[model samples]
Target chain A: AQSVTQLDSQVPVFEEAPVELRCNYSSSVSVYLFWYVQYPNQGLQLLLKYLSGSTLVKGINGFEAEFNKSQTSFHLRKPSVHISDTAEYFCAVSDRTSTDKLIFGTGTRLQVFP
Target chain B: EAGVAQSPRYKIIEKRQSVAFWCNPISGHATLYWYQQILGQGPKLLIQFQNNGVVDDSQLPKDRFSAERLKGVDSTLKIQPAKLEDSAVYLCASSSLQGGEQYFGPGTRLTVT
Candidate 1:
């Protein structure tokens, strides 16, 4: 069984400040990593994904993540955030074989203050 | 292209009542999935279907929950004698491939009082 762990439940930051949301996964087999953002009362939107190749993957909204194989972590980072960036971010993982079954972390709420 | 569509964005019912939610996946998509999201929690996969066939449903509670996808297009999820715990947002998603990037719907929020 695969699982994702997001150590931070909530992160508070001021506008224009950089932010990092940490994520760790436990999987014996190789896996694909993804980041999703959910706005209030809306469906989840894909932020970015790490399927293969470069460890550093860039995503929409100027967000990026690094897939660290040795550490089993895929952390989301943004050089600067805006007030509109406030939302709940989720980290998900699925094994290479069963990519349809996504295991998600608890989610970290990013609250951006003006 | 239209994304996944779910009907009755919000539903309210009493305990032990039955309720159903509908979903129409993106055109030409072959894979569909249903998930449950409780307040303050991440979405949990309840079932997955590939071209009208069940692929994975190990996490689904078969006793009170039933889902079907007809003609490899639209799908519906039903709950019989609903419990309070079933009061959560039911999300429907679809992907062109079995393991491709999934597109999610707005979800149907069910409240049981």
Candidate 2:
């Protein structure tokens, strides 16, 4: 079984400042990691995913995340956040050898202020 | 090119009432999924289908929830005798294949009063 943990429930950042949302997971086997962003009254949008290769993966909207195997972490980061970046972010995981059943963590709400 | 599609973007029903939601995956996608997202929480998988075959439904509350994907493209989810706890956003997502990046539709927000 695989489970994800997003440490912060809410993060407030100033516009143009950097931000990071922490996420950790527990799995007995290799896993696939993903980040999704949800705007008000909208569906989830894929930010990026880590299936293999380099630890750092970039996604749309100038967002990125790094997969740290040893730490069991996949933290999302943005060098400069915009006001439009304020939204709910989710961290999800799926076991590599198993099916594509994604297990998501409690979302982190990002509030980017001017 | 188009993303996953879902119908009746919002619904309201009394407890013990029944309701249903529908979904249409992106063209050529081979997998579909149903998830429940309660307020203040992340989405939880209720069921998964690969083409028209059931893949996993471990988290589904069998007594009240049921879902089906017919013809490998469209799907429906039903909840009978809905409970107050069933009030949440029901999300539908599809992927090109198993373990691939999924695209989601605007969920149906079910409010069971």
Whose DockQ is greatest here? 1
Q: Tell me the RMSD of model 1 versus the true structure.
A: 0.8
| lDDT against the true structure, each candidate | 0.96, 0.94
Q: How many backbone clashes does candidate 2 have?
A: 0
Give the DockQ-based CAPRI class for model 2.
high
Cα lDDT tens digits, model 2, A21-103, are: 99999999999999999999999998999999999999999999999999999999999999999999999998878758888
lDDT of 1 by residue, B1-113 (tens): 88889988999999999999999999999999999999878899999999999999999999999999979999999999899999999999999998999999999999999
Encode model 1's per-residue lDDT on A1-114: one tens digit a residue: 899999999999999999999999999999999999999888889999999999999999999999999999999999999999999999999999989999999999999999
Residue B88 displacement in candidate 2 (angstroms): 0.7
The C-alpha stretches of model 2 lying farther than 4 A from their native spots are none
Candidate 1, residue A58: CA error in Å? 0.3
Q: Interface RMSD, candidate 1?
A: 0.6
What is candidate 1's CA lDDT for residue B85? 96
Proportion of native contacts found in each model? 0.73, 0.90
